[model samples]
Target chain A: MNDPGRRLPSGSEPVPDPADGPTDGPAGGLTGARSSDRTRAAILRAARAHFARHGYERTTIRAVAADAAIDASMVMRYFGSKENLFDAALTIDLRLPDLAAVARDDLPRVLVRHFLDRWEGDPADDALLLLLRSAVTHERAAERMREIFAEQVAPALGEAVDPRRAGLVSAQLLGLALTRYLLRAPGVTALTPDEVTELYAPALAAVLS
Target chain B: MNDPGRRLPSGSEPVPDPADGPTDGPAGGLTGARSSDRTRAAILRAARAHFARHGYERTTIRAVAADAAIDASMVMRYFGSKENLFDAALTIDLRLPDLAAVARDDLPRVLVRHFLDRWEGDPADDALLLLLRSAVTHERAAERMREIFAEQVAPALGEAVDPRRAGLVSAQLLGLALTRYLLRAPGVTALTPDEVTELYAPALAAVLS
Candidate 1:
């Protein structure tokens, strides 16, 4: 579900400078709040890396905590059990662009480019790949994956095509991601990012139109 | 990498039926050969089903033997070991149509139709699905999958397009199979086969052309 190799930012929470004391006033409260947020974000990033690399059954909260450089007890206190941690870590935002705003013909190229960028932008940080890897074996992950596609992707492509057709578009795009990134199927991986976009854009365009 | 659930024909090698002596003539030899072939096929089928359902790590020789209704010794005697049995069972024949013979414009529709028919034809008997399920976790299975795509699929489509483009085509098609069949992603699986064909064929056509 998550890969452990990716490094999380050091120092789970930013420490307040000794010079800035309680006399620092309202800024102190904001800094404290921000520190808690940073800790949570760090835990989540570490958790995702573990899940992406090891999968649901094998990934342990302790390992995630170790990777995040936090105490295991802190992880448990913040996220409860491993399952809860996984649920928190894998909250995906596809961030599908608004198709309505783009020219109809430009949709396919836009969509392909966006996905290629997402996948190439960062391999270890990609939550979608985590879900894809885990969904194959874990029932909960599979359900989450289904929910993401149905709720986020389908709505984003609304009225550009029928719901069913939109689903097909998703299948095509996801397939490319699975082969290129997750499976590293040689042929698919051999192509440069631009080459992939060149080859896939038209096919996606056909689907969109 | 292989499942034991799909039935292989019984008998890995032909044995002369005890009822028919070697002296019984050519007819006796033919019947014995056919029986052995059937047994071998039965064992392979069972192996595929088991691997597909349980994955490489969990699938066992005894379970495959039990599913085939053959003695454990017989399973070993035929396929040697669990790993060897897996290799034997998952030898896929995609039976990709002769693309060179097909009209270039019709290639996409033909290719999509063939795969849809193959997947929908018999979910239980499909070796491809077994390989796909196993490939995610098992390095050996994953390697086999890569080899199959590179050797069988890439070569089949070679004359029609560049090898790199053929690989991209494989990614798209395999991705569809991954989401719809393996992950059972809600949106992709909901479509009827015809609906899928309608949506996917054009995209594939664009790739092929």
Candidate 2:
């Protein structure tokens, strides 16, 4: 448990401390204490909320500390700074399916389907939304969003397609996510996940081929 | 010239004060100077800069007023509120090409070519980027972005394609904007406008057909 005396931020009511509550360590002994794991989880959850809801600039360490019911100093001890926390919070692996393993003729459909599924499965799984939201307003956020797509999603897919064409495929696929997920275009969001997969698969196949 | 009597947030330095320098109005004409035109222009310029740079919430009215060298009260006098100012600032007419005039088989190419041209033409012409950047953190921004696409782009294209199929076009075209322009994915941005037109046109034709 953290030092209990710290005053939290305004507008947030502190829940019963999780360590002292049902999610607590086994009551038998101190050796069962997993305070470190609990603390990390708390910080991550709070950080994600802050980033997703208030964006990067509005999300301060003091605000996050208050939300997590932990000391502000404890947050710094764990994550170093707001930038470090943001880096950790935004570190998500999209886990896109292996396109090379898909049938060549069905590649577009498969890719589209996979992407639609990922998009529809969870609205909250949107790090892109968080990034897009922040990027519009902040230079650092824009730089980071670009860097992640370049370093992570593009390189992995570029391995399957020719490296030269990877950017095109990445652009289309990421664009699908942006329109369908973040923008929530009625035209984009209205499609059933299956319909999206069906319609866009051939397009994906064309890009890959 | 801006009234030096105004107070503004100290932490917001990236926002420049566009309202502060010398003005053409008479010295005693602060209230009735017809300087509202200048004030309105400054507000628009400041709004675009703030919305383009930081998005909605962080781009405070006070920050914009400071940037415009006007008092926050002047912004309220002209635009009513931040939400109204954002609506005015983000308004855009897509002015899509006449797809109906193109040869049937060549429609996709035409569509893709047009999209690529517009998407790449000016990074700042994007109302979508403005919305995306502000949406994650601000619900109003999200709603407005959704409304624009649903009301403007979708209706125009929905007339050409099946209502059901039109959304796919929205998804594809918008996806291009999100990935290529906003996200700045290397693979996405690397494609020449012509290549994108070539690659995407057939798919677009299919949707229409």
Candidate 3:
């Protein structure tokens, strides 16, 4: 039920009609960059949905292309191979709140709240679930997860606390995602976000300290 | 290298030769039950390795049979399908400590340590990781995980704690397994089991309380 129109990259491109699909035809010259960008975004959106549902190993280029309403060759031309496509599909910006700016006492609560908001905010669009879901199924996806922890998570929290335990923080958050979002475990999914914050924020604070 | 001899069902039946493979011939009469058990166990072990590495959606009956030293037909004959095989492969007993017998103050620590022991005791043999790893890729595996949480984890801890929070406790523990065991996140994997208990047990206790 995804709107292809809404999946377009935010830019100066002339927005295509919602019913026309991506762009009218093969792109060229002035419209080429815009058309390609829209195509890539559409492909990434489809790819993330597949990876989230089918996981890294089972998700196929053909399936992703079919979902994107493009030819399989187009997906290949843009993203190269399945592995590269996977990497492109799940490149997430955690948009971690500026931890350095938070009051020292507020860091744990803020971090926990930010994560919950990010996961619950727009689940269908978030690539983190796709990454986590695929991580267990493929080594490359797992490595990508490790990279996100090292690059995004660690640096984001490093100034406020011992960066090393960022992995632990990620573990707690990812585990919650695994249960609440992906597995939809009854007890976990049943909790409201406020309840999650009340119950989980403390554990995150404990790990940080 | 798995020894088929070691995989046999523990019973009065004579063990097979590791050198000779599973058994001498088609089992009938008295050896039937034992032979079948050995074959099933062998299949499960291979299936776990595959599920651990490949995720559920991608693991095939053919591949599992090849690894188990049997014909693909035999695997189907016993397990019926990939989904059934996945169910059989990942059926884990958390072997929770007797929470009812422990002092109330020690419940959290005891539970955390038991999970660590279970995970680290014989990692190759532990199906919990396999279950978690595959749970995201397929609905059946995810349901199986939910089943384990409901049946095994909730009941085991129901006596000492509010059983409903069992899912939260499981979330924390499962998160640790995701980063430390499955993803092998360096910061987390570097922690000694005691350190994990020290850092994480507090969160679980907080959730429980």
Candidate 4:
């Protein structure tokens, strides 16, 4: 589960450009591919914002275009459909710290705090949260979410523990997100970040070791 | 997450009557209330099946009625709308054990084994799993899910834990369900129930005492 009010960690993706212009490129021809890349990023950013707020069923191409300050035709041209746009927007990098670099005892605290910081950050855009919210109903979305975990988390954890345990780590943290943010369950929601770190790190550490 | 191929525990509901009739009721007049109750149960059973197979959106009143061998008009009359039927279908009881009666050292084993058993049991009908599947998109479904955990899980755990960790306990197990069953993540799904108890019970026991 996800909160629309929360955001992705800032600077995680190429900061989406506000304008659709190639003003930074002289003569423009050489920068054509870069300009296209910027436009795509801007569109994905807008799509994440819409999906985060409205979810899969309600978020429309027109709404995303309006937010990106582009035409609906351009939105369709880039993404083909609402479904494609949702998929493209879901791409995320967890930016996990190298577990091999961190001290063994500090591993649990680092893992716990990393997730809390990302999930608890300020409002703007969060693709992973959008995926979490939408994945419950959409099979493709669920697959992509798992792919993100398996590719990023499982391998990252392989450096420190059995890679198999990585899925459990995903489960533990994602479940925490569900209760604290999504379900707004009274118990864990009341705990501060420091308290969460103190309480959950051990549980996660158990999986890590 | 849920597997469509799996079933809820058997005999959890009155088997839907293949024939809708007053054949079993003597004279019909004295069994009016009893007949009505049976009809309600049959509709609910069929509703659960449809919702389970097709999920909340694709599942239709007509389909549920057809499955129950009842008229679509009767389905509308009884449940009012698909939303109402979805709400009614989500009702469940976890049938938690009285934790106060169990010994301290066995509490973690008991709690872990309990959830593993309920989640892993032979399929028939599982309302909680249905709620978990639907709650992702529907606000009301999410509310009901949290309520179920608070009402059943929190108090059951309060008998052993500090009463605060109950929410964490819910988060922990539900997350496990998400991975093992819904997401079918590689790690926990591979573990037998006994292995899950051995690995997770200590983690849970830490929360308990």
Candidate 5:
């Protein structure tokens, strides 16, 4: 559980006021509620960056707190422990497109282009990359990776291909991330996102078709 | 440099004897030399397993010696420092078949089969997996991985495809290794080697052609 004080604001008033709710609140009170949300968001952001850079084993609540510029207890009060914090930090949404609607021939290009955009677009929004950087060395992250592939990727591909082939497709996509983003392999890194999509889309097309 | 004593044995007599060489030795002396060779091989084997399991940071010489049932000092004598030992352990020969000689269409199946055989053949022979496990976390291992890709894989593919596509091919191959072997993702691991070869060969063919 997080801080009791934050959850049940102490006996400062005899009765709760419905007007305190943001929709009915004075501007000052709404700003105060917004500030609390901002702090929570900041902690989550710092935890994600730490987990991304250092693996599950090496990342510490204290370091995440330091990065967030808050006390270490504040981290514990919010997330409970390092493991729970990791679970909180890795709330990934693949945002996979509706492949069923696309022309079968275009699935590979569409999928490849989407991932390239996801990875290169904004570092903060790239939760998949965060999981990937940790997954190679950490078992928890790897399990989460498997779940992501199964839950988000597999169903999206639907019955269009065999399940095994779908798994292979995930392997290829994750492999690109592993080389270009995580390992920073020279050749993979040297390509522009457009170049990667150009070179990689056809291969994905082969797997898809 | 490793231990000087191992490199330069203390002399019983100054003159070098041609008969002492394994090729022309008395049967009894040859057996003794072969036994020594086996011990060295055992140490190297244990070292590879340790490095594969623990990565560069955690694998210690003492631990390798323990696994091999040799004195810790013998490990040092044979390998010098952990760095030199790692170098000795990772003497990988991809032994890639001659792509040019193969029928153009069959290149994918051959390459995929070769890698599957190499990976599943023997744990002792899997230095690339060891490097992959270490490279994610260790800077030195990552550099070595880059060199292996550039020097070995790139040259082998050699103008068969564009350089960037060659890199993508490597990414796909390495990604399979990452997911199936290192991460042990269940979906990828559930497939037999033949199944892998059958499924992966065509995707690779796309990359190559």
Candidate 6:
């Protein structure tokens, strides 16, 4: 298993390294591979955690490196810079379920459940939380929000509904999260989950109807 | 007009200088009252502009003072701190129009027009813009967003609809702003004014119905 002639997983298609490269040394030439994977994963994990807790401006590469038990130079070598690390760490494709497949009548209920599950499912979505928090102050964060909604939610709405109306419906759905969840506005935060679902379900259905 | 002995607009108020050993100049005096008034107004104007552009964290009292053409000490003396300045600058009670008085069928159109007017009415509502931009990164800013929704929106909705269902109804309405106006999510942003009214009116009405 110690053949140095093997290839490593570089996160994409494996291109043949030059003959002098480490791939041709033996069959399992992964002496540096496992450590590299661990280092990359650790940096990503720490970046997510730090970005969640501190927001973008406050997160430092040195701190992320400390959190990952790696050198700062290693982080730069891997991700180029703190900004790149953040971009990579937070680049989540919100794989929303197919909106067209759900019965229009059940759209609100389904949408609400999907959002709750997504937020409640992962603690690592701290970047999302941080982004939500920063959206209040940062234009770039707002632009990201616009991009996610436009690219992810809009396309899923299908072509039946007029595009303008479709966009408005999507806006309303995301706005609930912005105001109720992110802002924690008083009455909004006071509602039980069940109440939110019951009330919004019909409203959501009507948007499509 | 530069009478040192002139009293404030309030004909009977006391004016005392701390440097003068706290001796009351008169039962009602205006000593430097005009200057103080001008300073207060200038601070509010500068703060609103600064808060709109830079938001809470990035905005500084020093910058605000510079914008107002006053000393930094004057800003501190009037508003105490940046927080106080922000509070004073944004002490707006959003006076939403009466929804219950409108015909049920016309609710969406009315709501659309109202929101459009309110947002376009005041450029000083930079706090709203800031919240839209930075809600993803700052807790305090996000909290302010919640507070605005809860205090202004929830009360209006609770009065018009079933109090129990108001939160959900409120969420949809607020969500409209978040997606359409703030984030400018694609489909939502593309809707014409009349089309937005058509799509969301029923959804809004459904919350109360």
lDDT (CA) per prediction: 0.71, 0.61, 0.72, 0.71, 0.70, 0.61
lDDT of 4 at A194: 83
- Rate residue A145 of model 3 by lDDT: 88
Could you tell me the lDDT of residue B134 within candidate 1?
A: 67
Model 6 lDDT per residue over A114-146, tens place? 775455444334445555555544467667776
| Poorest 10 consecutive residues by lDDT, candidate 2 chain A | A1-10
User: Cα RMSD to native, each candidate?
Assistant: 7.4, 9.7, 7.4, 5.3, 11.1, 12.1
| Candidate number achieving the greatest DockQ relative to the actual structure | 1
Runs in model 3 deviating more than 4 A are: A1-36, A57-66, A69-74, B1-36, B57-63, B70-77, B123-126
* Quality of candidate 4 docking, DockQ: 0.52
What lDDT does candidate 3 reach at residue B8? 16
Cα DockQ of the candidate 6 complex: 0.43
Q: What TM-score number comes out for model 1? A: 0.82
Give me the candidate number with maximum TM-score. 4
Model 5: docking quality category: acceptable
Model 2 Cα lDDT, one tens digit per residue, A1-209? 22111111123333322222233556444243355656665776677667767667668999888878899999999899999898776665566676557666766676666655554443334444555555545557767767766676566564656644565566567666656656555666666767667766666556566
Per-residue lDDT over B1-209 for candidate 5, one digit per residue giving the tens place of the 0 to 100 score: 21101211121222222112223445466576665665677677677777766666788999889877889999898778999999877666676777778787887788878877667653433466677766766667777777777887888776757777777888898888877876676667778878888888888888777
**At residue B44, what lDDT does model 4 achieve?**
79
lDDT of 6 by residue, B37-76 (tens): 6567666766665766655678898988987788999899
Error of 1 at B107 (Å): 0.9
Which of 2 and 6 is ahead in DockQ? Answer: 6
Give the residue spans of candidate 6 off by over 4 A. A1-39, B1-39, B103-109, B131-147, B158-160
Query: Which tens-of-lDDT digit does each residue in B1-209 have in candidate 3?
Result: 31211211222222332321344555464386667767876777777777776666567888888878899999999889887887787677776777888776677788888877767654333367677766776678889899988998888776656544777788888888888767778878777778877877777777787
Score residue A167 of candidate 6 by CA lDDT: 67
Can you give the TM-score per candidate against the true fold? 0.82, 0.72, 0.79, 0.83, 0.82, 0.75
Candidate 5: segments with Cα more than 4 A from true spot: A1-36, B1-37
**Model 1 alpha-carbon drift over 4 Å, by segment:** A1-30, B1-33
- Tell me the RMSD of model 5 versus the true structure: 11.1
